[model samples]
Target: MIVPTRSSFSALSCLMGRLFSVYAGYEQQDAHEFLLNFMDKLHEDLNRAPHRKGPPVPLPALVDEAASLNVRINHFWCQHVDRHLSVISDLFEGLLVSSLTCLVCRKSSSSFEVFSCLSLPIPANKGSVCYLQDCLKLFLETESMSGEAAWHCPSCRQKRKAEKRMIIARLPKILVIQFNRFRCETAWQSKKLQTYVQFPISGFDINCFVDREQVETQPRPAYRLYAFLNHYGTLATGHYIAYCRAGHGGQWYMYDDASVTEVTLSESDKRNAYILFYTSVDMRHQFSSHP
Candidate 1:
């Protein structure tokens, strides 16, 4: 297997620090934050269409109610890819559809947003143990906008009570989920929630959270956990470690700052899971039952 030498790893780290000044020194950083920044920079550096220099012209709104959901999604995706097409997006990017309905007008509008990672909030009501599905449910629950938070309705011509719902419109080959473990109670105070979140090790189905209207005709996507990062300590000080499978359905290994060890994950270690990485399962049998 090809692996980076110690010198090569150090050189790459230095190069990253040079490119992103915030990572210049040996200061502790958030792994998710670093991952996002690194990916963004790498995407820009490796963008397939480097000649496109100006801001892309926005595509006109889809006004034809007769259009199918899948057609609309494809249109929006094509517009998005026209400007930002890259291998990174092909693998990690997915689209989120946000639907908002004004209570006064009863008119609804939907918008498409792209995401590379999902930062899911851990429900405060959850006790010591929580399930990943529970967090996803909370994230997808319809929210009401009222009072000062009301949305301005174009049809109603005023700020009004609205209902908002978001769902996955596209599924990426690689899915990255981050738990919002670090919370800020105040401007100067924050705490880390150490809730034990149990996630599936294999055959995780995300279709439950997808927009059923759009995917009813498409194949269901399944994911399998291949790696996860864990955090130890409080918000101010912490150490990060990773547990990864060696290969497809392989043994798990723990990677610390400098040491790597093969070990089975215990319940205690599982409690620290902060971020998870899942790859799409592409077996033909995985889709046979969906239709």
Candidate 2:
């Protein structure tokens, strides 16, 4: 049996349990098997002894490594082991369509990529109260890549200035938003952005960030906040804890290292939020109906 040694692993396990509970299509046995496989792989990869002592490793890197392993393990099980369990990918992965339009020729090109998380950049402006909507706006904002960084337009047949933007092509059952608070300009220089970003605890409408055509065709999807990862302290040294709500009872709990405590909704929604997790409201109802 795999044991949780770190807060990140425990938090992830809790989030996965929430996901499995909300999606009745996934079998408990299969989910348990997947978790075991993920933990085993993560332990093996992270426990490799080095030849000599080196600089201290960052916690974020280890968390990211564990997450990547989870994704890979989920993909392998869904694709190679059992195709019916592909709901794992459907719950988290979504398609993002990026468009690059040439300013001179007025021609546009588009590409689609699947994304598991949205990493939003924090503005450099200091002492400004920020909101999640502002970060979403910044993410979708069109930017003109001019000068040497200009894109090669096929129609213009030259390096020309282009405007690039990204929009959601497909929506997933679970949406994960990552606020990039860590900044590192050089190897030795690193800092954390302590900007206050306000996010809705429930009824977060994502239609505005999606493609216009998608909004017109499908019903507007609203999400309810269920879990979030919080980071405390500076960039070089910090701790990661998670706040999650029970799928059935709607009670919030905080997971810190080996301790778990019940917390109020107000307590769960804090400025230290680093990774936010939301689930589609409609799917929640659909799965709750199942025994």
Candidate 3:
């Protein structure tokens, strides 16, 4: 029955203030939102290059179409590191490569963006069941961008139909995945999908979801689930609970407000999962010291 000391409790309260200046006064908070805000603030506060003098240095131009994908990825990543260097960036940040290919010219342009979490969309299913890989695949699926969503191809010199696809270009030490369960069905209506998204507790490999051409060559990394946050009830009224691994290769425990209990998650419990936190199996030693 380990409990946080008074100092630790106060530190958590201060961290919450970093996330939100005005507390909701015991009103239920979205766990995902809180996590994101806290992470962002933590990065900002702990940034090594917090204040830069003079105007920001311009990024290197990516005009060379013949350059290899890894070259471009590294160029962008180096530029990013020059401005934002923090443990948060080192551990949690991952790069995504988004390619837009014009259907007419067949010419493609790619852009890289850094992300702290991967928000995956659940594909429409006849039954209320799907796997985590299905959601990841759905997220990485290419979509035809036409009509209003069309892209103006530089090669075609016109608004042409394009195929847009996104793939992971860099892997992070800690991967945070969020399920897009809340849906806006109508202008005034929204609903949460109770789809059972079965995820791997161990040996979770995301290599297939990554752009092998862009990423550096290395042995495949396996991730083990460390923690997951679940939301119960509707969008308006929901309670958040966390299931955290006790330690490296340890039992899972459910953490509710003011109560903690050992838990072997049932299928029903997994259905409520909102955010999943996974750590690289090779990095498991790092988390063994912390509960």
Candidate 4:
């Protein structure tokens, strides 16, 4: 090592003094968190630099995240990073985020992957990519919010000749749910016609029954649609079904309707099962065989 002269040593000592002085002025707990975070980011950024900007990940292997995923540090770390410093804050935060990454089995540029939070909200900070775990935790209701399952290989998803497994996810904290049923009334359409349905959703063993009326006839068939209500209802894995014939009004069906006189889930969030809009009479008429 090269020994420094008195003036050089003095300057170095002054620099360290300034650093400790500033650090000491802040809350000790904050300082500790800051330091621990800094060291972790420092290690990650150093390690991640070598793995970036390579060829695309493989194909068949790439489809599985367990095999193709690898975390990359999106930013770097610095000892001088302070919350007040905008540039340093941005850089260090990115490094910290990417460090806790979940790699795919075989990830490529085209993988149907996005981020979600594990513990906090997506983007609780300045720069946030959703963490995968958080994405999985939330039940997919709307088509837009659904992830990879929302869409599948068009060719592969329709294979009914062999074994098939439908995946349903139960999300956390269902706050409110609603179910509505309407009886169609029309003279011309009223006849000896009944619509009976038995379809599976995320929860509840349900059978929707619609029967025509011989009473005051209207322009349409009299049909009774029983949209059962189920809250936190457990259901077998299957397809989601829905249908509308001209003037029919309906809402979602929840469990806890039959035995309970008044089933009200005022302070509950609904957990949705994963299934696209599916409708077919054959699937509904098989309730007897299904146990």
Q: Point to the candidate with the largest TM-score.
A: 1
Clash totals for all candidate models: 0, 0, 0, 37
* TM-score attained by model 2: 0.68
Model 4: lDDT equals 0.25
lDDT of 4 by residue, 1-291 (tens): 122366874674465446456443422222123343444444444434322345333323234333322211111112222112232222222111111111221111212211111121122222223322233223221123124333233334421222111112111111111111112347433221111122232332111110112111112222132232221212222222222121123333332212212233221211221111212222234333333
- Mark the 10 consecutive residues where model 2 has the least summed lDDT: 76-85
Colliding residue pairs in candidate 2: none
- lDDT against true structure, model 1: 0.83
Each candidate's root-mean-square deviation in Å? 4.5, 13.8, 3.0, 27.2
Cα error of candidate 2 at position 55, Å: 42
* TM-scores for candidates 1 onward, in order: 0.89, 0.68, 0.89, 0.16
Better of 2 and 4 by TM-score: 2
- Candidate 3: stretches off by over 4 Å: 5-11, 22-24, 49-65, 214-220, 281-291
List model 1 lDDT by residue over 1-291, tens digit each. 233477877887898899988889988888999999988987887677534456666777778864666777788877778678666776789888888889887987778889999989898888989999998999989999999999999888899999998878888878999999999999999999988999998889988788676544354468898889999998778998899887667788888876778899777767899999998854244345332
How well is each residue in 131-193 modelled by candidate 3, as lDDT tens digits?
A: 999999899899999999999999999999999999788888899999999999999999999
Scored against the true structure, residue 23 in model 4 reaches a CA lDDT of 43
For model 1, give the 10-residue run with minimal summed lDDT: 282-291
* Least accurate 10 contiguous residues by lDDT in model 3: 49-58
lDDT tens digits, residues 189-258, model 2? 9878888788998889988777564223254478888888888887646777788887633788888867
